[model samples]
Target: WSSSLGGVRLINAYGPTETVITATCYDVPRDETLPDRFRGVPIGTANANRLLYVLDRHLNPLPPGLPGELCIGGENLAMGYHKRPDEEKKVFVPDPFRPQGRLYRTGDKVRMHGNGLIEFLGRVDQQVKIRGFRIEPGEVENILAGHPHLETALVAVKTDAHGEKQLVGYFRPRAGSRPEISEIRAFMQKQLPPYMIPAAFIELDTIPLLPGGKVNRRALPVPEDLRGQLSAEYVAPRTETEEELAAIVSSVLRIEKVGVYDNFFELGGHSMLGTQVMSQIQEKFGVEVPLRVLFENPTVDGIAAAITEALTQSIDEEELAGLLGDVTDLNDDDLNALLNDE
Candidate 1:
């Protein structure tokens, strides 16, 4: 029977001459519904006197949901491989708990998903961490697949020169139609939290498949190399006074000298930072800009010009002072006196 279509907990045993008659067996359940591309569980007992321990980097047993590497220990553990003692030494580690014994470090990363179920995450080498958060690309891809319009999606992490990591997603449309970037962004917004969402989305006609008939994530195209990849890039600053406003944004945002061609949120800016940028722009430019300015200009140069324009068209000093004074007096506690045409 074919591997994927089979409805049996099949176990095939094979091994090399030195490894002895294969003592390991992988269990594939009948009609196992492994979501996405997750494989089935492993089926191997502690051969007589062996031990299996799943541990984190700190050698402590991880909680059920937390992922960790699997270590195998016991008398059944193999001896040194040929004259490659150094290579053997790296794979075989001395167990801290068990005295006078070593364990083979299987590079597999897995999570105990409870109820006697252990879920394989991926290889430890493939795990990518960002901002002190351990992330599995498969988990993000699975979340994206939950969207109604998205037929399939794959997620990967891109690292810049400064060692900063960002998530990028590649997806195929359900039908023979092209989906707008805005629509995909909005759809992801509803399904995932901000950190989990892809910083950039790339739509494709089909996901590349490997020779083994699995999604070839490594072959996915990279995100476009847009100069200003943020929301601040689209708007252009219009006035000279706005030019000065751009300086303040460049200082606070710490970006590479922003211009009208840049974008605010696309430069990895957030709502809180937007408020600070706006406040500084208002103070330095002597103008009160709206919170919507960030969404409108989204770039230092653009926001500066917006402030300058708003200032130029604003009311004169006398009218402004009168308005302020009226507001101040209106707050006084003589309600009846004030209401009686005071």
Candidate 2:
């Protein structure tokens, strides 16, 4: 490794904000890969006097080789984030292993090794933000892996040429089995939200792995198009409202094209993204649409009708307001005029 780096020493450091700075360092060897190289780099033992503890979600210390959050309790650890008492109290809890001592809960998922090293696993919270929506890719992968045709699955976030983040899934099939992308997509649609479904699927004979047995994600090839598994024929938007709504959903979902009659939920929309879609419609067309309206009318054609209805209601309300003329009471003649005008 030093030969590629022109003969320089490289050090890997690990710590949390609560620790003020780094608490451990690893001197990388040239040929032998570190025993604890996982999430990014190996977090070696605590330096000097600092103590590192691996504990489960309930703050119970786990035996070596079990995955848990790495908690730090030592002199080097700072009290907590300043002015973030609510957050501070959540992470900096009384040490379960040591009586009356403070332990900083590092959100990182890691497992202790028998060699006195810790390997990073991943974030305790696997939620990933893509196009303003916090998505859980693991949830999608779990659904994909559950398919009988699939052996294993890996999901990742990829950016298309349009600068939009899209979820892409890669999977390997069982021996003597070949699964269609459309079949996998139909399987995912049964339980997952539209946003969680991958925009593209790539089949692999075998997943590439690193020397450390981790997936070599960078080696995976990019899919050619955004039309992952939706087998519908191309249908253009018929109305101006349909065209506008399709554009919004396509951009949000990172798909190249969408149909006017396509179900928004079927196209990967969720509650939070539904709010965005509704907000944009209101801003663009000057009509406030309730969240339930979108749920009830999921298609572009359906929503366009709702928009027209809202506008007509607004016109009727305005006419009624004008006829009343801010008066406290309306006579029969005034009410009759308003009714006749309608």
Candidate 3:
């Protein structure tokens, strides 16, 4: 029951009382892990007399790697919620395996990994599938908040008249800062999987808070006119580095005539492809730069300037060394070698 502080990973757990403290527990590791960020470790295995089944809406067992509602059955099932038959009906249902025994409808959507460990994807209510891919908004929001300049982030999915889902991100800049939209999108590109990246970003002064002081997600303003404000007509890059940056954007965005002021992510670039563009740029220019810098200046012109500035700094160091005699203090080995050469 310990509270989490900075650098602490929070793992919220749930299990019915009849199952004893908890029949199962999940351990979410600190930020970075090998394969995926959302994958968690199971604290215990299914013991005898108890059964855990992940099922679809039809109560049929789901195949592995697929997400479905979790149903808990066996001897540890609760008698039923007291004094409320309707409430009891909501959670307690007849088990398919036992034929007559009640099963607890946990309402949690989970996917069983190969090792028998379940990956919790949030409640069925919050679970959303976009573009035929299941998406957990909380997972995307968590990745965005890890950025140094991002104070807060919120992910929302809206369906169009055609019922096509579109992911949107709302964020507030940290104190003493206003970062470029390109930068944030680029940062997200590295942190999330392809489908998890938001389609658009909206800057907010503050996220509406509910009566309980939690995020008032329902009250979030729609992004109908927000796009026109964040990005106006494209601004062309002014420097040689900006030209190079524009080239990268042109390739990824498929727009030959991109302005230096145009945002990379705004023009169809996402986190997954953003990494590709970054890798290409690094290989082309031979410089190691921070991912956070993209958030600071997300346009081609901005990236070019950053690259040019870095290159200039390197050149300045070399020029300074040449101007001031040899940079080396002249170790005995070097001095003797120099004398021998003379």
**Ten residues in sequence with the least summed lDDT for candidate 2:** 32-41
Residues 158-182, model 1: lDDT tens digits:
7644456767878777786576665
Q: Is candidate 1 or candidate 2 better by TM-score?
A: 1
Model 3 ranges off by over 4 Å: 1-12, 16-23, 27-50, 82-87, 127-152, 158-166, 172-179, 186-199, 203-207, 224-342
What shift in Å separates residue 244 of candidate 2 from its native position after superposition? Answer: 4.1
Clashing residue pairs, backbone N/CA/C < 3 A, model 2: 194-268, 195-268
Off by over 4 Å in 2: 1-95, 98-127, 132-136, 175-183, 189-195, 211-213, 247-256, 263-276, 295-297, 316-342
Give the per-residue lDDT digits (tens) of candidate 2, residues 124-243: 787688756778676566567778887788887777666667788899898888988878888887777666778778888788989999999877777675444455555788888778
**What local lDDT does model 1 show for residue 159?**
61
User: Could you report the Cα RMSD, in angstroms, for every candidate shown?
Assistant: 7.9, 12.8, 14.0
Clashing pairs in 3: 183-294, 183-295, 184-295, 189-271, 235-261, 236-260, 237-260, 241-304
Candidate 2 global lDDT? 0.77
TM-score of 1: 0.55
* TM-score: model 3 vs. ground truth: 0.50
TM for every model, in the order presented, reads 0.55, 0.54, 0.50
- Report the number of the highest-lDDT candidate: 2
Q: For candidate 3, lDDT tens digit of each residue in 41-103?
A: 443345556688889888999988798887888888778767999988877888887867878
Off by over 4 Å in 1: 1-50, 80-90, 127-138, 145-152, 159-165, 173-192, 206-219, 225-342
